[model samples]
Target: MGMGTTTIESAEVKAAVASLREKAPFVYGLTNYVAANLSANVLLALGAGPAIGSAPGWTGAFPAGAGAVWINGAALMSSVTPEALDEAAATAHRAGTPWVLDPVAIGAGAAEYDAILGALLKHKPSIIRGNASEIAALAGGAGGSGVDSTLDSSEVIDIIKGLATRLDAVVAVSGEVDYLCDSAGRATAVRGGDARMPQVTGTGCSLGALSAAFCAVVDPFTAAAAAHAAFAAAGERAGRRASGTGSFAVAFVDELSDL
Candidate 1:
């Protein structure tokens, strides 16, 4: 379904977040080692079941049973072969299941991961969420350092839009403002998150995970919006209650659970 000009409101996003409790969806993640724990925790906080699996045989069967699937290219492993990921992503694509792709530190990783990421790009993902540098690299632009963006998200809107057009997916660029854009000319910005968010290790990846979880119940466009909106809300509240990154992470997760 084309999103067209749809702009999601915070109230609607909160409702979608609440719906997760009733749906109790399972969001499968073939994610990086670093993001895996926080991603799973974030899903649990949002009342969704999370399964982080990179086992060889799970490629086909995991997404078949999952409400949504998330593919994160953060940490490449010897066991989680690129071929296995290809099969898993293909399974989700063929099944018409919603999935999110978080291309973490795309260029900083081992050289082989570049090929793996390129291979997965052929498959259509429901959404792609990444920092400006990551998104730029995905669009054949220059990449930045590991997980640290050289360019601001706002600086790469055109690149992201073009990539979203070519990939037939909603692209979400995370920064001071989160922009969700699709080829259909639909774009929206979500604001109101704490500056301390970047200090946390898994915040961006967790958002991608939450996007996948939301996709199980809603369309990709709304899923992106809802994920950012929910994060913005919880992060703002968490920042008010906590002192720094450590306490903020705990409070953030707690706020999500309360929401």
Candidate 2:
């Protein structure tokens, strides 16, 4: 993502945030790792109750009242079996809850990515969130470097649009200029985030969770915008006050609380 090239639409963002407070749905986070826990924390900080239930056996008990569901592929390929995830996704779908998919590390391992992504799609995710590379790879674009999408926004626009159409889901590509689009061929770009953001580890995961929170109440467009707003605002706050990654993470959480 670029440092100072784009700007966030604040009015639209505030409206989205307001809608979230009213709905306040239980959010189910299916991502592995304590880093994923940071995302759960971000959701709580933003006023949504989070439920962690990635296991197939426990998935049946996944809060039926959940506003939205988030599945992060971060540690899933390593620990969680594909069959289990497929079942979990099916459970979420049967409940009629909008689910979000985070295709982490799509750029690196083909086998792992295919397995996890296949299970995720079985659930028919309502929204899909990822970095440029993850989104591009999912969209069948040029392969990426590890999990990081190296393609510039311009290069991946067509790829993202194509994938969004194929999946029939809202696709949010995070980078210097975040892009959100659906099958209708309509795409919006959200600008403005600190360059220091990539220095932090869990910020991307957190954004995925925030997107889930927004999806709990608003349309895909509004949810995508709210997530962009939360991240940009958090980045701005972190940039102005923090000295490094550690403090940036702390400050980002503080900013979310204020929001």
Candidate 3:
């Protein structure tokens, strides 16, 4: 029953998803500017409270009752400065609040982002999701510049395993197939999303937000799987009716709501 000891189960993953709908956990995000609106909308569709926190107001105080926090390392300092990012991470770490760290485009950035991400790494997140390149770079491996991935998901398995061990957190590797790797090196393949899923922006960002929502009520592994399940399921369904990227974008949110 203790955290990190329980084995992941399909039943538990489904249960976590069901619980989110009932609990409607409030998720606070310090995310990318480009993906902020879509992230909020996806969380809303999943029946989670979504709010974006910024500097000054959120500096001294965490939200009144946020169930979880999501720190997206995209468009750094969109509403929060690096100092504020540090403060929020420390706050969440101290409160034992679950948070997801989406290290978006940490690769090939300036040394400032490296430092900021390094600081947040001190406060362990419940789950960390990233593309192969992002996670590889964060782990000090060779990676692409910006959001592009030079490595496939499978190519970075060792990097993911090592990073999960180092961070003591669940790591989700996103690609055509998702691999949810735990600190213990346990890996689960979550396959459901369609190719169209990637055509829409913020799908990955929203997945991180959704993982934070699930983290509120479940262990990290299940929480990550639940996110993979919800997003991939919705994406697969949305792909059925959507003819283009524009239609899939709208229908993706609708499918998420229906899911």
Candidate 4:
């Protein structure tokens, strides 16, 4: 079937946001060091509990018990080993815990890094989120420079649909307009985020973590779309009040809380 496109309504986004506040799901993130603080803060602001740990023992335990899990490929470059990430994915799978995979700088990395991310595909992530370049790379195209997307989200709609179907997961490509596709080839285009969002470090990475939080309450497709919708809405609000990227970061979290 051809991919169907739709926009996430404000009511749907609001319902998902309200559910997060009511449930306050515990989200375990094995994310990169640079994104850890912001990722956890984003979860907290959304009224979800955040736990970030990648110690040998914690990796297996946290994902198994938390409401949801987030695994960022950038974590491998930091303190988390490939084995730990694999174990986390395995554990989440075994426990039927929903998890989001952010393949940050996937194709741009060395062979070992790319191999680690490729191996993760076997575990079957609930959602896979990345920039246009990263998603394109995941679909066998060239990767972005570092974590930056070299292409626009619109440029990779078909790849996102293919990846979503092949992986049986919700795949989200973040750019000027975020695109999210599910296994059934249904896609959502969320537009509203500010340009300054990319200027703040970890904003995109934190979106993966936020998706995990939403997954704890909704289906993978809804969770992924809601995350983008929430980010877009909050980014729009924050951009209006902030002086620069630094203030935008703070205001973004504040807007999330207000949501």
Scored by lDDT, the top model is 4
76 Cα displacement, candidate 2 (Å): 1.5
Model 2 TM-score, all chains together? 0.90
TM-score of 3: 0.92
Q: What's the TM-score of each model vs. the native?
A: 0.93, 0.90, 0.92, 0.96
> What does candidate 2's lDDT look like per residue over 188-231, in tens digits?
77776788887777778778888889988887766876888788
For model 4, the superposed segments whose C-alpha errors exceed 4 Å read 1-9
Clashing pairs in 1: none
Per-prediction RMSD in angstroms? 2.6, 3.2, 3.4, 1.5
Q: Encode model 4's per-residue lDDT on 1-29: one tens digit a residue.
A: 44433333567777888899999999998
Write candidate 3's Cα lDDT for 142-214 as tens digits. 7567766777887877777778888899998888777778887677777777887766778889899999999
Model 2: lDDT of residue 18: 71
Q: How close is candidate 4 to the true structure, as a TM-score?
A: 0.96
Supply candidate 2's per-residue lDDT for 198.
78
* Total backbone collisions for each predicted model: 0, 4, 0, 0
Task: State the number of backbone clashes in model 3.
Answer: 0
